[model samples]
Target: MKNSNIKNIIFDLGDVILNIDVPVASLSFAKLSGREQAEILTLFKENDLFRQFETGLLDEASFRNLIRKLVDSPDWTDEMIDTAWNSLLLDMPVERVELLKTLRSKYRLFLLSNTSSIHITQVNKILEAATGIKNLDELFDKVYLSYEMGIMKPDPEIYLQVLKEQNIKAEETLFLDDNSDNIKSAAKLGIDTILVQKPVTILEYLKDYAV
Candidate 1:
């Protein structure tokens, strides 16, 4: 049964609200690094630099430098690195933002994104061009970025911190994410969760809840 006491909503950005193409990033990196897409995938998936970058252990410059080293190209420009890294991000749907606006009247809204700095700049630019909004804070009550918080999802600490800081009851909050592990982690902490599968949208899922 859906929780009637859900007074706050915590949303995951990638794939849940934002349109992301993970394979696009692999293709971009393949072209930039002169390596096969499969190799690029394995390198990044197994590399700690990507996780470190997401959790703020690695700054933007250091992250780019690591990418440059991986590509074995001493002269890779920052733009090239950013393009490859941000290739996964597509566009934010207007409907999702509109849904957020409507839900804000009844529920406190928050954004918890496991994302990097360069991706955020691109996201803002795209969102503003489409919706005329400056950034996500205009839609959400608060935005918790993994890079800024030095914590990422599935750790349980980040979710706990958000609940404590926002003074929200775990049982009264609904968390939505595209990752199963993330959904499980939140559920374990007493927060209701939806594992948002692809082709299933936040707007569709929240219809009855928001109403």
Candidate 2:
């Protein structure tokens, strides 16, 4: 594949730009609530709470309250819940940051992620601590977060909304995501897409464009 018509690049956050381990967070929550990790993971999927939180349908306090109830731990403080919730967010590699910097010179870069406020805050802190970059805004031309937009990936409306709001053409945009469903949705709308999978980071996938 060549990049002859790719004017705008939209990148995913988790498992694409930022490293995340969902099982790690599940384990942390399990330990906190004295439940099995498998059970904790199952609970996370039972009520669509994760999706609700990512799409801004559920506020932080309400999400936390629901989590406490789900875990059967009524006494867990806000800080404790937040820590467990943020455990999945690992780090943003410096090389990936450098690649974004290099690519910014050629393409209008954008970030599109399904995320929550708590995770975004922690990710900014991690980015600042690691590379002295205050936030993701420093790396991309613009950012589109699901919680802020009240929409999420795999939904055609979100992709269409980004295109409409940015005044960018779908044919000229290339979307890279870790999730196949998101990639498929973007592709259906005439946007080019790459499914970034494990072991092959964006740096490897988009190495040609970094130049």
Candidate 3:
């Protein structure tokens, strides 16, 4: 069922490759300030914490410190913040990495993610330190991050930018994202897409391609 017409494989980096553990951070905040997860998330999100953090309106240190304060716990330590921020990191599967290495020769690979500079640094360090998958940088022809690009997924403009930059037709590009809304947005732009889900990784889903 694979479409041979697809020439470009656009990947969503987080959750697709690097696992994201949002609840860990959310729960940590809740526990630190003695609040419920729902309440903590509401205040954190309502205050535009992620947007500001991504846009560099607030630096990493300041962002963490501020969020801790909002949780009403000014006494929280740096370790607490780091632990909360990083609690969601999961191992990158070697099998998937090898699969990508094989796919590199056949199709152009690109990485698109809604990420901030701080999170990327942490992820890079964690990934390289543990797995030594050094070629991740070389495998992808382009790596686009929302914080750096000023546009995030689920936004048509970001998808437009990718097709424009690559000079490729949307139909010829297969975008893989863990976020359903992002897939829907790209689908609207005429791009082929796969909404990655639980128990199904990009590699497992694409294995039948027999490429």
Candidate 4:
């Protein structure tokens, strides 16, 4: 059964709805650069380039250029870079799509993801292929992308902006994300949250509501 007090639901894209493997992408990049996967993963953690790209501080071309420099592969093409970067995005399960469709009928649904333009494009393609949905906009009442909004999650400003724009109360909203930091931030704002961790997807977590 749905939470009676919750009128809105905000969903995180990666790991929550869309399946992603960060190490898979790192491995792909590593193969291309002849570096160990651990080295690539460490680079991702230590560098702010990804955060900059997610927040729209870097354009696609500039982001690609920076990636080339980081991997020390100046000859890598845009297609190659995008392919390696996009390897993390796996698939959107059809059942998750069905769950969203069912929930949409009863609540205001929203997509709030910290992602770049490149990932969004590929995700939409994945969505289209899986469920014939044109885009995530069709699944959610509103979509707040980090690249479009100039803000990222775990930041109070981003959560506040969504609440302000949607005219929704924090206490009446439910947020689901795979990241504990993100769940903590939302909880601090008085929004109910579920940390969608391994062995328990949003589908499994909200099975009663789906029923």
Candidate 5:
């Protein structure tokens, strides 16, 4: 399908623009929790705490308390917990930001990320430290965070809400995400989508569209 009608672009944060290392997080959490890395990974997949934290259902203090309980260690400091939790956020590629800068002139750009407070904080810090940009605000017209919106990707409501708030039509909007489920959900809503895959960055995938 031709996406020449797509004028607004919605970009996913993790794995699309920023690199994520889930195994690194598991290893880091394992160090603090005294559990095996495999066990920690399993817990991360099976536990509702992670999803709750992402959707803002659990406050930072409560999330930390839950983590403490899960690890069976109440004495761990907030910093330590944050360190382990943030291990998954690796880095944001400068090339991706440069591409966004180029595309901003051609498309109405927005950021739609499913992330929590801790992860967002770390992402901002990494961006500022590496590129001298405090956050993605300058790169995007609007930023919609799942934690702040109390919604996440793969949910039809979030896409509909973005379209309504941005005053854009679904057929005119393009959504790029690394996850297939997210792409499928957006596609179901009639939004053009590109499933960002490994070995091919967003720039590589949308090279023709941006021009």
Candidate 6:
């Protein structure tokens, strides 16, 4: 397909622009819960707990309870869980913020992330300190977080919602996300997408995609 139809841009937060370290998060949680990483991760996936949290099926407190239940440990406190989960939002890439800003001036830029309160709180605080940006509110034309939207990426509905809210056609939106599944899901709806690999920033990707 041609780039002629592209008008809006939607971005995924973690790992794409925010630089999530999955290893760090897993190791941190493993240490906190005093369990083997494999064991905890097994339960996390098996229970669909991660999906539930990202997709907004569970709130912060409930997610903590779910983790505590998995560990069967009374030591799993709120601070401990928050610390572990927030490890993923390690830092924001400076070049990415610049790229987003440049794109915002051109396209109707939006952020659609599958994130929860614990990480979102830390990300906002860090961005304020790092870039002096007000917060999520000042960042994009609209910010659609899964915890608030009741939908997450890899689901077509979430992308549809973005298009619907912006009153833009799927053909007119280009989605930038780190996950291949998410890219494919958006592509299924005829939306342009770029699957980001490490060490390549958004600026480089957009140079090829943006007309």
Question: Compared to the true structure, candidate 1 yields what TM-score?
Answer: 0.96
Model 3: per-residue Cα lDDT over 59-129, one tens digit each = 77888778767877778787787777777666666666777778888888898888777677777776676
- lDDT of candidate 1 over 90-166, digit per residue (tens): 98899888899999999999999999999899999889987999898898999999999999999999999999999
TM for candidate 2 is: 0.96
Model 4: residues >4 Å from true position, as ranges? none
**Tens digits of per-residue lDDT for model 4, 141-165:** 9999999999899999999999999
Residue pairs of candidate 2 with colliding backbone atoms: none
Query: Per-residue lDDT tens digits of candidate 2, residues 122-189?
Result: 99999998899998998998999999999888999999998998899999999999999999999999
- Please give the lDDT score at residue 199 for candidate 3: 83
Report the CA-based lDDT of candidate 4 relative to the real structure.
0.92
C-alpha local distance difference test of each model: 0.90, 0.92, 0.80, 0.92, 0.89, 0.83
Candidate 1 vs candidate 5, lDDT winner: 1
Query: Which stretches in model 2 have alpha-carbon errors above 4 Å?
Result: none
Model 5 TM-score (2 dp): 0.95
Give one digit per residue, the lDDT tens place, for model 6 in 1-211.
Answer: 3376777888889877787887677777788767888887888889998789887899888999998888887677798888888886778867778777777777888898988877888998888877888587687999999988887788899888888878998888888899999999999999988888888877777874444
Global Cα RMSD, each model: 1.1, 1.1, 2.0, 1.3, 1.4, 2.0
Better of 2 and 3 by TM-score: 2
TM-score (all chains, Cα) for each model:
0.96, 0.96, 0.89, 0.96, 0.95, 0.92
Q: What's the lDDT for candidate 1?
A: 0.90
> How many pairs of residues collide in each model?
0, 0, 0, 0, 0, 0
Candidate 6 error regions (>4 Å): 1-4, 208-211
Worst 10 residues of 4 by lDDT: 202-211
Worst 10 residues of 2 by lDDT: 202-211
TM-score, model 6 to reference: 0.92
Q: Using TM-score as the measure, name the better of candidate 1 and candidate 6.
A: 1
